[model samples]
Target: EAGVTQFPSHSVIEKGQTVTLRCDPISGHDNLYWYRRVMGKEIKFLLHFVKESKQDESGMPNNRFLAERTGGTYSTLKVQPAELEDSGVYFCASSQRGLARSYNSPLHFGNGTRLTVT
Candidate 1:
């Protein structure tokens, strides 16, 4: 199965510009998650999508950030009016539902989308 993939391995933009990062999860996987590690902070969960529906999004930083899963397949995370503090590595992961229940079936992360807000 193909693992999660993120686009533009890296991005750089001005403080007020908008940027969209894309993620493609493994085929047939029903669960997709978004995570990020900003500077020295611990990796934090941004949101989770069970298929095309957002099961949780409590961790989203602010109104400027948005996440979406269309057709229960690929997902996209958008940051509008970026800020210097937005620089970080964004990761996407997916797993088979039943198998994912086990700790062994950990989320498969992409190399990560590195965004640099100037």
Candidate 2:
């Protein structure tokens, strides 16, 4: 019954450094998603995982970013050679597998991790 949880609510790193964000979704949820909102921009989808497989990753920004779901229980997002443009609030969400794509499904979200690249 717990909601999604994200670690390191805030992070400040230098450009070219590497940072990893973690997310633990609600138990029994089968669909996980990553999203971010850059300065002055609306939140945008980054990627999605269904169980341990990546269901969609077309929204990922670039090659420097990597996403993984371990054992279909928790997820991680790593950004290497971080750029200032990558600074934003990264959000994690989850929903039941079959209900995810439907309008009636509700996605539970984490508080989000705020990353700042200097």
Clash pairs (backbone) in predicted model 2: none
lDDT tens readout by residue for model 1, 1-113: 66678997999999999999999998987889999998888999999998999989998999999999989999999999899988999999987677436545668888899
Tens digits of lDDT, candidate 2, 1-118: 7999999899999999999999999998889999999889999999999999999999999999999998999999999989999999999999886643555668899999999999
Worst 10 residues of 1 by lDDT: 96-105
Native-referenced Cα lDDT, model 1: 0.91
- At residue 93, candidate 2 shows an lDDT of 98
Judge candidate 1 at residue 79 and give its lDDT.
Answer: 99
Q: Per-candidate RMSD vs. true structure?
A: 1.8, 1.6
Q: Scored by CA lDDT, what does every candidate get? A: 0.91, 0.94
What are the runs in model 2 whose C-alpha is more than 4 Å off? 99-103
